[model samples]
Target: MSSSLHSPWQRHVPQIQRKHQHWLTDTGSLTQKLKNHCEQFVVQRVRQNRAFLNLSETKSLCLPLGRRILQRQVLLICDDSPVVFAHTVTALERAGRDWPFFNQLGNRALGLTLFANPLVCRSDFEYTRICAQDALYQIAQTALHTHHFKVNLPRHIWARRCLFQHVRHQNSRMMVTELMLPEIYQLEKTSKAR
Candidate 1:
C-alpha cells in the first residue's frame, strides 16, 4: 500500500456532515445499524485470501514481513444498496490460535461476531477522507459497480478504522477499515425525509 493512501487517518474525527460523523464515531455494531436501516441486509464477501500486510497494518499487528496474513474484504449492503466496504486484516498465526472463526466467516458480518464477544476490546476510531485517486476509493467504486448501485459517485469518500484486540490474548489483534459510500448519506437523507 502506498504511504499516500494511508496519509490521512486521523486520531480525531474530521470536519464532516453530522450524518457521516454519526456513522464514523458510532461505537456500536455497524451490522446491526444496517439491519435496522433496511429490510434486506447482506454481507458480500468480495475477496478473502492470504496477503502481505501493509506497513501500517504490520506495525499495528507487530508482525514482520514474509509472513502471510489473512486479508478479507467485504461489502455491507442494505436493501440492495452497497453502503460500506470493509477491509480486515489479521495475523495468520494469531488468527488461527485466537480467532478461529476468522477463516470461516463468509458472507457473515464480522461485526456481529466481534461486538458480541465481551472479550473483544476495540480501540478509538481513526478517521480519513479518500479521494478518487486513493486505493480504497477505487475498491469502493468497483464494489458499487459490481453490486449495481445506481448512485452518483462523489469526488471523495469518508472512512474510519480501528484496531480490535482480544482482551485475554495480548497478541491477538485485527485491524478493520470501513469506507463509507455515497449511498449511505443518501439513505440518511431519505430516512430523515420520511
Candidate 2:
C-alpha cells in the first residue's frame, strides 16, 4: 500500500495507523463522513486569501512559476471540536469563472460542493506525513496558535491532497488538502469509550 513518493534520504515513510487508515483511504465526501460521525458538524473558515502557489502546489495544478492563487483554509468542527484542517487553492482567474461559489462559500464545506457538482472530477489521492519542518504544517500550526484553539500536535500528522478539475473548463484546476488533527484521534477515542 506504500509506494516511495519521496526520495530515500528524505526520511523513512511513516506507518499509517489502523484507525487512521480507514479514514484516510475513504474517497467519499469527508464532510459527510464527519457529519455522520458527530452530532454536530460545522465548517469554520479560517483563512481565504490570494497568495503565490508553493512549489508543490504549482506542480500539482500545472501552473507556471510566480503565479498567484486563491488560498483557503478551514477547520472541520465536529461536536464543537476542530478535528480537521483543510486547505485549498485554485488559480486566481479560475476562482471566479470556474468556481463562482468559491468566494461566496463562507463556512460551507468545500468537500460537499466539489463532490456534489457533476462537472468536477477528482484525481487520485496523494498523502504525506507532515512534521515540524513541513512548510504547510508550520502554517497550520501558526494559524491554530493565533486562533487560540489549543491543540497539541503529535510528532507527525497525516495529510492528503488531490486535484479537482471541472470538465467544462480546461483550466479549472483546484487542489484540496486535508490534515488529520490530533483532536480527530481524541474524538475517535472518546466515541469508542462511550
Best candidate according to lDDT: 1
Model 1, position 146, has a per-residue lDDT of 73
Candidate 1, residues 98-129, lDDT tens digits: the string is 88888899899999999988999999988888
Error of 1 at 57 (Å): 2.2
Q: Give the lDDT of residue 32 in candidate 2.
A: 79
Candidate 2 lDDT by residue in tens digits, 111-179: 998899999999878777777667777777877776777876776788878889999987789999888
C-alpha positional error of residue 136 in candidate 1 after TM-score superposition, expressed in Å: 2.3
C-alpha lDDT of residue 57 in model 1: 63
Q: How large is the C-alpha RMSD of every model relative to the true structure? A: 2.8, 5.1
Candidate 1 matches the true fold with a TM-score of 0.88
Single out the weakest 10-residue window by summed lDDT for candidate 2. 1-10
Of candidate 1, the 10-residue stretch with the lowest lDDT total is: 185-194
